[model samples]
Target: MQIKRKLTEREQKLLQILINERNKGIQEIAQLAKTDIHDLKTIIDSAIDELDLSFLNQNKEIDCTLISAYNEKLKNIEHAIDRLAEGNYGSCQKCGQPIPEKRLEALPFALYCVNCQKKKEEKNKEATQRSYPMREEI
Candidate 1:
């Protein structure tokens, strides 16, 4: 069996950053959960006063969106941690090249390097345009 290698300083730093980000996300979600419970109580009390329910519904929708966004960020951070454990955290998944240190520092959860990411975005944009063509003015 091969011996495991130690992580470099940069890798350790990246791992710390990912862990910090994950913790922050969890704390934010927990805070949001508490706020949601309070909001629900407020909504019930306000409904008894014949207040507008639509405003409460809008608030609920916004809370849901925030929760979803936080959950997605947490998932990405978890994936990055897993990749770091697998010894491929700083490599581009699409092109199989080492991702730039600056890019990784900016977005530790990035899967594709800059070029591959740009290409993927362009392709997605093209597909979106095709799916919803603009109408010509009459």
Candidate 2:
């Protein structure tokens, strides 16, 4: 039988540092990593580049928008953390089903299972479309 590797203390420390220094400059994380500046810059730069590609498409003006989005995402994560502290993190918010441990491990901020999340997203999309329906010539 294969056992899953629980996140180690060192790994947890690294993750904590990374999360806390997310808004700080690369030099700070480099110092924490105990690595050379160039190597630290490369790691931070690559992560930022990947994030830009995914969220901002490298547009400088969209930085504020990305920040807002990130803020909202963080709020959700905070709510999840609150649930975790309350001993309710793994249950689906909508259906009360137990969220899989694998899913929770992959995304500690997740508040819903796949089905509940999809349903909520679909409902939100429908509401958005209804609120701003496109006009078509008949």
Q: Tell me, by TM-score, which candidate is best.
A: 1
TM-score of 1: 0.58
lDDT of 2 by residue, 1-138 (tens): 111445445334433433443434344433434446676455444554333323333445444454445544444544444444445556787899876666665665667999999999999999998888878622
Model 2 deviation from the true structure expressed as Cα RMSD, one decimal place:
11.4
Summed backbone clashes in each candidate are: 0, 0
Can you list the residue pairs that collide in candidate 2?
A: none
- Model 1 clash pairs are none
Query: How accurate locally, in lDDT, is each candidate?
Result: 0.69, 0.53
